[model samples]
Target: MEDYYVHPTSIVDAGASIGRGTKIWHFCHIQSGAKIGDGCSFGQNINVANNVVIGNGVKVQNNVSLYEGVELEDYVFCGPSMVFTNDLTPRARYPKGHMGYKKTLVRHDATIGANATVVCGHTLGEFCTIAAGAVVTKDVLPHALMAGVPARQIGWVCKCGQVLDKNLHCPDCGTQYLFVDEKAGICKCGGGE
Candidate 1:
C-alpha cells in the first residue's frame, strides 16, 4: 500500500522513493533514483529528475523541474516555474551525461521565487530568498535577499522570511539578529541559543 498520493497523470518510476504523505499532482514525473521526503507537495507539470533529493516539508509550486544534482533541504520552497539546472555547458552532438552535471544545494528553509533560474554548482544558503525572475550565478549567503538578473544580495531576511533592516531586526516577526561567521550565518540576539 502506498502512503503517498500521485495523481493519475503523474508517473513515478519503479526505483523512485517517495516518502509518506507526499502529494504529486497532475502531469508530474518522478524519475528513477529520485528521493522525495515526507509532506512534500509538488504541483502540476513538475519533473523530479534521477538522483534528485527533496527534503521533508518542501513545497514546490507549479511548473518546476528539479533536475539531477539538485538537493533541496528541509522546508524549502520553490515557487512556480523556478528552474534548476544541472549542466553548465551543453552541446547537442556531444552531450555530457551525469558526469558533467554540477551539484546544487539549497539549504534548509530557503525560498526561491517564481521564474528564478538557479545556475548549476551553486549553494543557496539557509533562509535565503531569491526573488522572482532572478538568475543566480553565485553562492548565496544565509538569510540574504537576492534579486535582479545576476542575483545580487540586496539585504538580509529573517527566519520568518521578512526583510531585515540595517539593525538586523525583523519588523514582521519582532526577531533580532546577530551576525555570525560565514558558515554559521546569523544567530538570534541575546543568545537565543
Candidate 2:
C-alpha cells in the first residue's frame, strides 16, 4: 500500500523514491532519481530535481525548486521562494552537467529563511539559521545567525530557531543552546556529546 501523499496536480516520476507519510502539494514535480524521506511537506509549485535527497520531516514552502546536488537533512526548514543553485556558471548556449556541478548540503534541523539563495558547494551546519534573502557562498557554523548580502554571521540562534537570549538560552522554550566565540568558532549545546 502506498503511504505518501501527492496532490493531483503534482507529478512524481517513476524513478523517484518518496518515503511514507510525505505530502507533496499543488503543481509539484519530483523528477527521476530523487529520494524524499518520510513526513516531509513540499508546498505549491515545488520542483525537486533528479538525484536530490530530501531528508525526513523537512518542510519546504511554496515556489521552491530543489535542484540537483541539493541535499536536505532531517528536520530542515526551507522557507518560501528559497532558491538553491547547482551550477555556478550559466549560459544559454552552454548547458550545465557539461561543466559539472557542486553540491549544497543543508544539515539537520537547519532553517533557511524566505527567498534565500544558497550558492553551490556550501554546507549549512546543523541547527543553523540562514536569514531571509541571504546569499550564502560559504559554510555556516552550527547555531549561527547569518544575514545580509553574501550572508555574514550577525549573532547566534538556538536549535528551536529562536534568537538566543542574553544568557544564550531560548526564551521561548527555556531550552539552553550553544554559543561559540566569534573568533574561535567552536559550538556545543544540550545535545552536545
Candidate 3:
C-alpha cells in the first residue's frame, strides 16, 4: 500500500509526490509535479496545481486551491475557500503560463483565514495570521495580525495564534515579543514559545 491515503473520489495525478501519512479527502485533485509533504491533510474539493510545494503538517480546508507558484511552508493552515492567485494580471484571451505566474510564499506556522484572497508575488512571514475575508496585496511581516481589504497589519500575534497585547505579550500563552522594526517583531519567549 502507498504511504499516503487518497480518497476514492480524489484524483492524484501521476508524478505528484504525496509524503507519508498525508490524507487527501474526497473531490481533491493533486496535479502532476505537486509536492505535498508528510502528515498533511487536504479537505474536500481542494485543488493542488502543478509545481506547488506544500510543506509538512499543512492543513488545507475545503474548497481551497493552491495554484502554481504558491509555496506553503510547514504547519501552515489554509482556511476554507481561501483563494490564491498566481497571475498578477489574468486575461482569458491572453494566457500567461508558468513564465507569467507570480510566486506567493506563505512561511511556516502561518494561518490564512477563511475566504481570504492572497495575490501572488508576495511573501507572508512566519507565524503571521491573515484574518477571514481579508485581501492580501502585499508582503506580511512575521507574527503580524493582518485583516481587512489589502490586508494591513492591525497588530502582532503570538506563535500560539493569540493576539499580542500592547506590551507585546500573549495573554493566552504568556509569550513575550520585542519589536524588530516598524513592520516586524521577534518573539522574546524563545522564538514564539
Candidate 4:
C-alpha cells in the first residue's frame, strides 16, 4: 500500500492486510490473516500472529508479540516487549492449534506499557493505562491506571494518558471523565469533555 511503509527487513506474509499509512519497521513479522489498520506503527522485532486484529492509529513499540485472538481498537498504544497470550494454560508441547484461542480485546485509546503481559479472555477498557512490567490477568476498567504484578488499579487516568485529579479531570488535556458503576461490577467512563 502506498500509504504504508514496510522496511525491507520486515516479513509480511501474503495474506496479511495492512492499512493506509501504516509503518512496519525492521525485523518485524506479520503473519497471514492479520488485519492491521491505517496509521499504525509496528516497531523493530515485533511479531503479529495470524488472526490478530489491530486498529487505526495504533502504536506498537519494539519487541512486542500480539498472539492470535487479540484485537486492538483504534488509537491503542503497545509499548516495547509487551506480550499478549491467547492460551490460558500454555504447554511447551501442546498442539490444539487455533481451536484453543481465547479472545482478548484492547479498547480504544488504551495504553499498555513496556514488558507487560496481557492474558487472554480479558477486555481492557477504553482510555485505560497499564504500567510497565504489569501482568494483566483480569479486565481493566475505563480510564483506570493499573500497575504491578497481577495489575491492580492504582488510580484513574484520562484518554490523554494523564492520571486524573480529584475532580476526575485531566490537567494535560483538560478532558473530563465520568465513572459509573453498572450491574456488571464494572466502571465505565463517558469519554472526554
Residue 62 Cα positional deviation in candidate 1, in Å, after optimal superposition:
0.7
Name the candidate that leads on TM-score. 3
Candidate 4 error regions (>4 Å):
182-193
Winner by lDDT between candidate 3 and candidate 2:
3
Estimated TM-score for each candidate: 0.95, 0.91, 0.97, 0.91
When 3 and 4 are scored with lDDT, the better candidate is 3
> Residue 5, candidate 2: how far off, in angstroms?
0.7
Overall lDDT per candidate, in order of appearance:
0.94, 0.88, 0.94, 0.89
Query: Per-residue lDDT for 61 in model 1?
Result: 99
Give the clashing residue pairs of candidate 2, or none.
Answer: none
Off by over 4 Å in 1: 181-185, 190-193
For model 4, residues 142-183, the per-residue Cα lDDT tens digits are 878899999998888876688888777778877766566532
Error of 3 at 59 (Å): 0.1
Question: Could you give candidate 1's per-residue lDDT for residues 1-193 as a string of tens digits?
Answer: 9999999999999999999999999999999999999999999999999999999999999999999999999999999999999988878899999999999999999999999999999999999999999999999988999999999888899988989889888888888898888666677784222
**Candidate 2 wrong stretches, greater than 4 Å:** 177-193
Please list all clashing residue pairs in model 3, or write none if there are none. none
Error of 1 at 188 (Å): 2.0
**Please, what are the lDDT tens digits per residue for candidate 2 over residues 34-71?**
99999999999999999999999999999999989899
Q: Judging by TM-score, tell me the better candidate of 1 and 4.
A: 1
